[model samples]
Target: MATKRLMKEYNSIQKALSDTQEYENIVSLEPTGDLFSWCGVIRGPSNSPFQAGTWKIKIEVPQNYPIAPPKMKFVNKLCHPNVNFQTGEICLDILQNQWTPAWTLLTTMSAILLLLQDPEPTSPLNIDISNLLKSGDIKAYNGLIRFYTHKYAIDSV
Candidate 1:
């Protein structure tokens, strides 16, 4: 029997899948184990250094779900402050201790999208990249981000 929490998370995922916007660039989801765990994809935003790139990510819903945000990691190569290059582990506030029960999958996805736009250098998973991002050298930063985008992100169809 499914617990009420799992059912709510399932519903939230369903709603997010249905209402997702095109520009959001999230590809799809597939079950990895039970109803709570899934593998997903999100395309990099356009007009940024990551434009024309697609990155695969994994989403693991916790047993507590909404009360504790889902864990997400990139399955593809990535170079960013909030994302670990080796493990693809992400560092995001909402996904950690600050998570709130009212947050939905859509909101989580939006946060991921925004992270791609502005990575948090203060709390960084990739220290080198974080330092570069903090240096105020826009050209170098764009170049580095673009290089990683080409190495990891895929072209959209």
Candidate 2:
């Protein structure tokens, strides 16, 4: 069932890419070898610090996918409150405790695009970035994100 489902998703992504729009933020989503490992590229939304960047992500689907959400991490470094700078581990509820079987890989990537725009500082992986946001230093926070986005997030998969 899991393999069948993963194959469906793989085809879905291919179909999505075939369209002209091809998911506005999703640059690409391709399986590495089999159904379990995949790689993707997500372009940052406009009017945001990450606007000029394209971020790559790695995905690992568990055997019980749908029942268990696939694990994802950034291939390029991203400096944000909810993302671990060193490991690229994301701190979003949907990727963790709040996940539901109803969520698809495409929706999850959309959620990540939203995260780039609106970060939740409360549960942060990068203390410095989180603190800046928590303290209401919008200028510095945006500046750092912009800086890092240019430096690290510009690389593609």
Candidate 3:
């Protein structure tokens, strides 16, 4: 049952990515050896500071997933308040304590996409970046983010 559910979810994700006309940002989603693990690339949202960056992400689905949230982390470096600069740990409630079985991989991915655009400063993983964001230095904060994005997330092709 667990494998079946995981496969179903994986298929749905692949289907959604394949239908690129309807979706944006997400560039590719490929299973890494198994249905439970995947690697994806997302082009930064066009309207954001992250624009032109192609970020890589790693997703690991637990055997008891749905009941427990899947582990999602950025594979490339990101300078965001809500993300751990070194570990890439995300500070999102839904991926942690607020997770519910009703949420699917697609929903989680969507949340991550939204997060890139709107990070929550109050519940931040990187205090320094959060301080920069809240210190009324929008230009400086965005500059750092854009710099890191270009340094680590630029697509090879």
Candidate 4:
């Protein structure tokens, strides 16, 4: 059952990427070895500090997927309030306590893109970045993000 659902989700993701411009930032999302493990790349959203950056991620889908959320994490470094600088762990509700069967991989990736655009400072993995946001230091926050984007995430091809 889980394999069937994952194949469906994976197929739909590939089809959308090929047939439409909607998920343009999602560079790729393909299986690593089998249906349960995958890798993906997402170009950061435009008009944001993370612009031009390429972020890679790993996805480990549980056997009961759709019923239980997949475990995902950045494979590249990202300096953001909701992401751990050293570990690349993400702090997001949908990936955790708020997940539901209704949320598909496409929607989850969309939510991650939204999170990049608008971070939630209240709960954070990088306290320094979150503090900068909370303290209304937009310049410093944007600067740090840009620095990290350059240092950790640009893909030329």
- Please list the C-alpha lDDT of all candidates, in the order they appear: 0.76, 0.86, 0.83, 0.89
Per-residue lDDT of model 2, residues 4-119, tens digit only: 88788877877876785747888888888987888889988888878879988899989898888889999899988999999999998988888898887887888998998899
Give lDDT tens digits, candidate 4, residues 26-135.
88888899989988888988899999999988888999998999888998999889999988799999899899999987778778888999999999999999999999
Query: Which regions of candidate 2 are displaced past 4 Å?
Result: 18-22
Which consecutive 10 residues in model 1 have the weakest lDDT in total? 1-10
Tell how far residue 52 is off in model 3, in angstroms.
Answer: 0.8
Ranking under lDDT, best-scoring first?
4, 2, 3, 1
Among all candidates shown, the one with the greatest TM-score: 4
Better of 2 and 4 by lDDT: 4
**Between candidates 1 and 3, which one is better according to TM-score?**
3
The global Cα lDDT (0 to 1) of model 3 is: 0.83
User: Candidate 4 regions off by >4 Å?
Assistant: none
Q: Model 1's lDDT to the true fold?
A: 0.76
Give the lDDT of residue 42 in candidate 4. Answer: 89
- TM-score winner between 1 and 4, please give it: 4
TM-score of 2: 0.93
Compose the digit string of candidate 3's lDDT tens values, residues 1-157: 6688877877788788777665577777767898789777778888988899887789898888878898999888888889999988888899999999999777777788889899999889989879998887999988988888888888732
Q: Model 3, poorest ten-residue lDDT window? A: 17-26
